[model samples]
Target: MDRMSAQKRRESVIRAAIAEFARTGYHGTSTAAIAKRVGVTQPYLFRLFPDKKAIFVAALMRSMDDTRLAFERADDGMEGGGQALRAMTGAYAHLMSTCPETLLMQMQGYAAVAAAEAQGDDLIGEVVRAGWMRIWETVHLSLGADADETASFFACGMLGNTLTAIGLPASAGR
Candidate 1:
């Protein structure tokens, strides 16, 4: 088999890490599992990432970037706040249904933040908060910079995430 480049291996590790972390969370996931998923040895995974925390952070960042791009793409060439809002909403819904792992990884990121903060480790929280702000800003601008509208949109999105995490159908309370 052909050998993968370092960059490609790193990307594979990140993808595998996302799935593993989504399933087991930061505290529960082990580097061995991530390496196994990526078809690499644990030492090679470490060479790609300094430690498990690094791998988790990379996965979390990727998930956030993916989300931000989804909103941006959905709002591309759209006019009017309501129209952009609907487009972004549809994009998010598609992401939820098709890329459930991303959603799960995002939730796990939030949970990991709280866990890390309690132990006086704020790095994870910092990364998550910054990433979240990027998403918020993207939505805020796409929604015509209306603060109330942006808040309402995120409020609904968070609720949706919670519902999905709990295995509630999209039509559960409707």
Candidate 2:
């Protein structure tokens, strides 16, 4: 079998890690499981990532990048904040339905940051906070730079995520 490039292997590992972390969270996920998911051995996984924490961090960064790209694409060619807001919200809904694992991984990443900070590891928390701020700023800009509007949009978004995460039926909103 032909060997994958280092960069490709790292991407694959991050993808697999995202899914695994989504399912089991940071504390529950293991490098061996991520390696198995990637069709690589544990040592090979470590070679791609310095350690499990590194892999998780990579996954978090990938998730943030993917989300930002999605928003940018959705808002492209749209005029006015109302149109952009609608487009971005629709895009987020589509992402939740199709790539729910990524959102789940994001939630896991937040929890992991809190846990890490509790253990005197604030670096992950700082990175996670920065990623979140970027997302917020993206949404804020897309929604016309109104502080109240952006806050309202995110408040609704959090509610939507909570409803989905708790397995609420679609009819529950009725």
Candidate 3:
């Protein structure tokens, strides 16, 4: 395949994989399913990612990075946590309108993590914690809080609020 076509194919697969993995979990998502979704075969999917796990990991990493970047960009225009969160929420609401699949994938990942926890697996938990700490640290710095206790104090609280907001969006008025 040509370079652009290959790149497009990869993106299509990733998008489809995100939805599939989100719906099916990492273990349940099959290469054939993703390939079929991307209008290819199982072997072609393998050409992009050696295995399903690798693709799921890549998608999760991309999601985390994208969230961080979005937060930073939205935060840049505001001076306080409340204002920043408003902008961030607006961005999220906009995203919710535009790219709902990304959000759905994230929600699916959380569900998969919960399922993993039930099965005595902690991979998603560790990954989620690390992703959270990064966000909390950023929020702490934004708040001009003491760095020494930031992770445990502000970061922890912020992380809790975030999960809560995501989990209880309707109840939280988010």
How many clashing pairs per prediction, in order? 0, 0, 0
Candidate 1 local lDDT, 84-162, one digit each (tens) = 9999999998988888788889999999998899999999999999999999999999999999999998888887787
Instruction: Tell me the deviation in Å of residue 28 in model 3.
Output: 4.5
Q: Which regions of candidate 1 deviate over 4 angstroms?
A: none
Q: Which residue pairs in model 2 clash with each other?
A: none
Error of 3 at 26 (Å): 3.1
What pairs collide in candidate 3?
none
Task: Please provide, for model 2 over 1-174, each residue's C-alpha lDDT reduced to its tens digit, 9 standing for 90 to 100.
Answer: 998899998889999999999889998999999999999999888777778898888888888777777888898888647899899988888877777777878888888887898899987788788888998888888877889988987777667666666776322543
Candidate 2 or 1, higher TM-score = 1
- Misplaced by over 4 Å in model 3 are 1-8, 114-122, 143-174
Q: Pick the candidate with the highest lDDT.
A: 1
| Selected candidate, larger lDDT, 1 vs 3 | 1
Measured against the true structure, the TM-scores of the candidates, in listed sequence, are 0.95, 0.93, 0.68
Against the hidden true structure, what lDDT does model 3 obtain?
A: 0.65
Shift in Å, residue 92, candidate 1:
0.2
